[model samples]
Target: MNFEYMKNFMDSLTEWIIPGNSVVIYKDGKKVFEYSSGYSDLEKKIKKTGEEQLYIYSCSKVATVTAALQLYEQGKFLLSDPLYEYLPEFKKMYVKDGDRIKAAENPITIRDLFTMTAGLSYATNTPAFEKARKLTDGKMDTRTVIKCLAEEPLLFEPGARWNYSLCHDVLAVLAEVVSGMRFSEYMKKNIFEPLDMNNSYYHTPNDVIISPQYIYEIQDTKNIVELQQKEHTTGVVKRAYGNELVFGENYDSGGAGIITTVDDYAKFAAALANSGTGLNNNRILSSATVKLMKTNQLNEAQRKTMNWRRLRGYGYGLGVRTLIDKAESGSNSSIGEIGWGGAAGATIIADTEEKVALFYAHHMLNPQEEYYQPRLRNVLYSCL
Candidate 1:
């Protein structure tokens, strides 16, 4: 692959984008390109390395889903199984209408959570979610927060519509209950260890120094500001060495918690791209299971319900976004490319058809990542 243009782009990140960034691309289970630029801590003058860990945010969802599927492969639960079976708090949930609350027509199923159709919204301005947040205002336990989420009314009836939400957070608790292990423990044993992803974790290690996070501000058009520490009520907390909420004693968030480095994440991405086999020749997931994960699982209505602009030509899969139409997506990626991104400009795309896996990590909190992500895809796929 021609990496001249890619190298130029990486070099420009510190000047044009964020202070530090890393990119890694793998093809056929081998590293084809890898690059890092700028400092992990600009104030401290620490250069970024392949081992510098950063919070992956929502990208952690795919790992949680992969762990859940391992249990599914073992016949522990079915996609159609009602969530109430695992967490009885969801036995009789309700939905909040304009001014009234009504009983949900059906119970939320495991598949509904995977497809974002469970009507569970994130902590938002809505009355229901606001109340949900209050339940765990100063707490860190995953089961406690999830049960509180269940007590809150849904935004819509289960399976009636799709909404990006805290459904995966609940899935984390379900995985723990089903696997008879902690969420992080299950991931380490079944996913990270097998793939040799030594730098991935639900919590930042106590001894390792991590890259500092930043936020691009419109007020300072030419400079990025270091993100200050703040209390977060959404069950996730932003910290210097990655996020702190997932580090709670009993909380292992599935939606947005895992921290990893470029090479470590590439290992996970390569396994997905290579039919669930890691570079070490260990099977992290069955090939059939990976195929199912990459397949579009949403129906027409659910597809229509997606609110994110970047999901225009994509469809919801188990955990990642599956490219259903290359032309409509306005990119050169082949159909069936599956991946997800974090809020802090971290993204991973695994194209099974091209046998390519691409990962980009930057510690800048930029909502405009939609622009850069596809740009990266277009550049990489064009070279191919």
Candidate 2:
């Protein structure tokens, strides 16, 4: 494969857009190509070693879905089963009307959480979270916080459409409840342990130093400029969020909370690409289950809500976006190619059809994904 063009594109990105980026690609469960471009500490001139811990934000959902599916494979729950079956607090949900809220017409199903059709919103500053904070004494544990979320009104009836919300976080609680383990504990024993992903974590270990995170603003109409950490008001220095999505010590944000390195997380991506088996020959899921993981779960009406520009030719899968239309996307990716990106430039590409996996990230927040994601996928396919 000719990876020269892809490498050059990455180098160009480090020069102008974000400070630095790293990528690890695998084919058939073996590392094929790896590169780290630019610097990790731009101020200190420290290069990206491909070992620095990065907060993968929404990319955590990929792992979350994989974890929950293990339970599915074990016959712990069915996709169509009501979420209330596992977490009884959801038995009586409410939906928001114009200025009033009323009980929801339909119950939320496990399928709704996987497909992001649960009608939940990304809003976190509601009274529900506040109540949860008080109840947990600021710990904001998974079960208590998620249960409090049920008191908040949903945007619509469950399963009516797709909405990117805290559904995966609730799925984390599902894993915790059914497996009788904390979300973090369940992931470590099931995912990290099996795949040999030693560096990934739900909390930043005090010993490991994380990469410096940054946020940028538009300098001119077309140029982007970096803001010093002290000058920035939005970014949380070196992490994805402080308490926005990841609540506290006890909370495990399956939706947007994962701290990992490119080299480590790529192993998980490679497992998906290699049909649920790791490079070390550990099988994380059955091949059939991996296929279901990437299959498009959205219908025509539900797809209308996934209007992100970067997802032009894709459909929402269990958690990731699966390629559905090549001509519409102008992409060279395989038909069932699936993956997702983070708010801070982390990207995952899992093409089980071709046995190819790629994980990439730039240590910057508010990653302009629209410009790079589709192009990067298209370029990777061209290299192959």
Q: Pick by lDDT: which candidate is best?
A: 2
**Pick by TM-score: which candidate is best?**
2
lDDT (Cα, tens digit) per residue for candidate 1, span 156-197? 999988898888988989999998998888899999999988
Q: What is the lDDT of residue 305 in candidate 2?
A: 85
Query: Each candidate's TM vs. the true structure?
Result: 0.89, 0.94
The per-model lDDT (C-alpha) reads: 0.80, 0.87
lDDT of 2 at 258: 93
TM-score of 2: 0.94
lDDT, residue 151, model 2: 86
In candidate 2, stretches whose alpha carbon ends up further than 4 angstroms from where it belongs are: 219-243
lDDT of 2 by residue, 1-384 (tens): 878878998987776556788999998777888898888987777997788898899999999999999999999999999999999999999998989998899999999999999999899889999999899999989899999998888999998988889999999999999999988999999999999999999978889877888765434333223332223233323444443568888889999889999999999999999889998899989999988988899989999989988898899888889999999888899999999998789999999889999999987776778778988998888888
